[model samples]
Target chain A: MANYLKLYPIPEDYRFHRGGQISQGLLAYETWGTLNEDQSNALLILTGLSADSHAARHGEHDTAGWWDYMIGPGKAIDTDQWFVICASSLGSCKGSTGPCSPNPKTGQPYRFDFPDLCLEDIANTSVLLCQSLGIEQLQAVIGPSMGGMSALALILNHKNYTRHLVHIASGMASPPFSTAIRSLQREAILKDENFNQGYYSATNWPEEGMKFARKIGMLSYRSAKEWNDRFPRSLKKVPQHPFGIEFPVESYLEHHANQFIHKFDPISYLYLSRAMDWFNGHQYGTPRGANPLNDISLHSALVVGAETDLLFPVDLQRELHHLLLDSGVDSELIVTDSIQGHDAFLVDQQTFSQLVGDYLSASAV
Target chain B: MANYLKLYPIPEDYRFHRGGQISQGLLAYETWGTLNEDQSNALLILTGLSADSHAARHGEHDTAGWWDYMIGPGKAIDTDQWFVICASSLGSCKGSTGPCSPNPKTGQPYRFDFPDLCLEDIANTSVLLCQSLGIEQLQAVIGPSMGGMSALALILNHKNYTRHLVHIASGMASPPFSTAIRSLQREAILKDENFNQGYYSATNWPEEGMKFARKIGMLSYRSAKEWNDRFPRSLKKVPQHPFGIEFPVESYLEHHANQFIHKFDPISYLYLSRAMDWFNGHQYGTPRGANPLNDISLHSALVVGAETDLLFPVDLQRELHHLLLDSGVDSELIVTDSIQGHDAFLVDQQTFSQLVGDYLSASAV
Candidate 1:
């Protein structure tokens, strides 16, 4: 890996789906390992809701990767054997051109002026990032949750852009329930006084609203079975604040929500959540009942799902797998029994690794 | 049936389990139909989470009931043949003596000064109400959700209080996940600026926070199958506000939350939800592997549950049924296949009514 963080410019006349354009924009990205001389061993990794491009340990300290369990020297998607690139999704606050980014024309932050984004723009931006690095995809693209939606958009639209796709716990589009929950989260932020109609300065954050949204998001990410198994109904032996955490699960949600508020931007979350809701493979001219993989038969894909995931049901993954097979594409579905729900991809790393690793290595041949 | 909403006095020394006691308190109740000559055919009806004593209509109008589907002349628990009583739980805001009720000594609302209540208190208060009505034994005690908890408490403590028991979509104790979600809801309310340590004026509600809690509660009450089935990912043709709803499911939750806020009292909700968490049937001298129905061998019980319920899994209801049978009680269990989750007891009225009605009539004969 040559650089820990890299920035690239977008076209001056670039426009997004919802009628707004940034004359000039910069996207921040991070990469690991070396691209082969022929530029044929590059793997692209897309992220979930609020992660940045730092996908693994950067320097001396054992800094954890979001997917650190599955990506190292001899790990599942071995960084030693394959060059991996991760770009911050467009409209994210993590060193990317977003609502928080300064406007080139007005010499101030875009704030509420940022364009309404869609799933396609996120997919296209990642493609543009790969092109800027002079890399024609050879290895694969891996994504989970919203990232999987991006992977679906990328491969289904670009066809031969990648050789393999690893979609975990995601579907072609956000279903009604998922979209509705996200809408509630956005409403929480919008209704917050500190949000100030997305005009709050860098120091004045919508902390309360973002924290509220994260609490809801955490519950949706995991299963009730898992929570019941992990926590108990008894109150804590020792109390902290006046309003004590009577149950362990409540404490768990509170801790995660607090941690998330420190990192995620309310505006970025609003845009990204909406983008996820708007995703659908059928919308891209691949009519209903037809496979998104029908036009790209050469790409072999691995779809992994958790049986306990209420958000993205295992049946949807099975549906996609069969659709790909019927279209003559080499596709396999792995439905694992896990209480971790949609989060099984991250928690049950060993199983996810073995299935994804074997498929990636086999397809690389 | 006498008074539509009658208030009863509690003894000054009536202390709850958690040591806080109102020197003097009142409980409000309502009833329907005539008690049989011997008062042996009186049916006691308990409610779910936050319902009042009005289980059905009181007058000659098409005025609806929450359980309006299954309780009427020639209906499930046919009011024509039996008397029915619905009492507001001890901590409810509807007509019950709750936190909002004035402190007899201080002439002010109890607020946080109210006792830390338990399911037992709620159950015992109903018994006191019955004693006041000159009823000794009941034909049946039917309850759903939290009401089921109260029924369990009543039968376990007062073994011969009822001739029959009907428990629906509830268990002996609140599971860890349900308690955790409830604890979070409490936190959301308390953390609100308007909540003011549960001292807010009745007119000035913690509207936003309570609405947020209700949204979370509604999601927990129903299953993912119901949500996805009820709504689709289509935005309205004409948008109303900047952040218009992208799915009908959002509108449904918003509407429900609005409705709930208007009727429910937040302070009472806090006490009742906590009381639900503290409910553990085994703690009341019923040891492990010991059925609460042990001494009531003459009582026949019906335990009904929903296969899709993530909150109160059907296995708990099945375990209780088996426990009753082991105690030489004529008990039966009904597990309905429905996507409505714990709410199946409310939605699938025909199935529920037929099963309950058959058992009651057979036991009567």
Candidate 2:
């Protein structure tokens, strides 16, 4: 099980884009394995859009982590050999200071008043977490998907504490395709009459809107081939289900929507997707003025991509590799053939695990 | 506009699966260019899902037909030389007898009473159309997407009709991916609260449901990359638009849906999608079963695929080519590199027109 501890900063002037301010704030994080003397073997993992710090462990049920395959003993990440830490990013819902978190002034959930956050804020808070844990430096930093973007921000914007980087299915900045999908998903949520301008009452959450948004997202997360193979034209025996959707695929979508609503916060999804859309290297003070490939120092990096990933696509990976090579960085690119698409990193565990293991063992960290 | 006159005693009876009978229906068709005395210069063009018999013409408005680029004079199909005829398929919303047509027996629209159609019905009707025009054989039958499927069916079931075939972004039969997408679109309509269970009154149609269905179809019709390029994340400076969607892409979808609802029939969409799913060579009494290559006499065929076509990937085209070769059919396979996805046949008109033109001219009846 993964647990969180909140660290509050001293009162300081914090201004927000939406004409709001927070005097002080609490940051939430979780840790795994054990910190050794000298604190140089720590590895930090950032999470994706709806994920929390509970990346690798189930609570009291003795269940596995969201990324259990990569963090077990003798695994790719090797939890037993190195101390690992993951944090519930700011503006997120899981044990973090976000829209669902209680406001210090009002004693109620911030909701709409939650300030906008960027990757730099996340990286800065992570640095605080490391300092609080008495760690002076990190051996490596790794993340997947959006988490990978966060890791890149930490490596590029923050000091060179991390000696090695492993970013999978991420890019230097948000591509137009990602922005378009996010924009549509956001529209799906906001256009719902039930959204009520993002001020829904506690009892009447916009479940339908959130489900529609998730359905749109599910389209991008998996390959068309996988969908075809898993749920064919075969209709349910009943022909006409109570929901009026006859095909098994519609039922599968409904099931997927329900699960997402149960596990994720609608507001968090909105904020994270927006943050991803707003991600620009130039905004974070990149020397090349937003050209991601032009302004990064990578001592050693491994970039992995999924061949069937329509969302990220292999072209993005190839672009990232070319950028790294042009920047005179020692970077390796690997493409994994999987029908899982964007979710291949999570679903195709064996191949991903082996790829990460081989890359880490071979790299000079 | 190329108008179709209703003719009685359509050469054959359309045998439906549900034991319903539609007897003696006539399909009006138009031909371009000159057919030689031996009737060897005939080229049969198949209509798409909702297209009409007016495939191409030199109309006063200069609006052109749906496939004018491929069938006009000096264009592909070469109106200057080959006699090209495009006929509306049976059970289509456009000019064809469909669910919206009035039932002589009940003095009302067929609606739910319309017979469930199969691919054979479409092919058989096409054969009837050909016979009415005094044509016993075709130089080639060319179609794109659904039209492509119909072309393959024509040669497989009616061996004496088409000697050459060209199928673009189509398959031997509908794959599970196509079926699943169509099923989802169907479910979107059927699940609409106002659907009236496919029994809407003549005056009160479920336009919202139909629009949603079209929106879903549009999503699959184009590639994600194309969408990204076309609709970047540019916020409208003035947010006071009556339409609530903020993003241009969202607005585009709304507009597309509304236009489709105005011109397309909901019942016809459902029927056509179902017919596509039910396409099987075995069901049509073909010797080699549903596999197009297994039991058909294909003299020379040209198969074209769009590089970004998600509905029918290039790999599927390759599979068809391999199958044809293995079955001793002379097949020429060419993949069109376009970002238009399944709709590439329409967008990449110049290249496709040339391909179809060369293929049709080289294969003389």
| TM-score for chain B considered on its own, for each of the candidates | 0.93, 0.90
| Residue-level lDDT tens digits of model 1 in B104-222 | 78898998788878888888888888878878999999999999989988887677899899999998787776776677687678877888888888678898779878887876777
Provide i-RMS per model in Å.
2.3, 4.6
- Model 2 TM-score, 2 decimals: 0.88
Tens-digit lDDT track for model 2 on A1-365?
53344454623464443344555565666676778887877888888787777676533455666887788568888777678888888778777677766788988767667776677667766766777778777777887888877887787666466777888887766665566567656755665566676666557777766876777677678887787678654456454533355556667777888788647666777778877765654354455344454555557788899988877788777777777787677889999888899999999999999988887777534
RMSD for all candidates, in order, please.
2.7, 3.8
- Using lDDT, give the best candidate's number: 1
User: What does the lDDT read for residue B182 in candidate 2?
Assistant: 74
Per-model clash counts, in order, read 0, 4
**TM-scores, chain A, per candidate:** 0.93, 0.90
lDDT, candidate 1, A110-202, per-residue tens: 776888787677777888888888887657888888898888888876778888888899887777667766877887788778899878765
Instruction: Please identify model 1 stretches exceeding 4 Å from their true place.
Output: A1-3, A58-62, A237-243, A285-293, B1-3, B58-62, B237-244, B285-298, B322-329
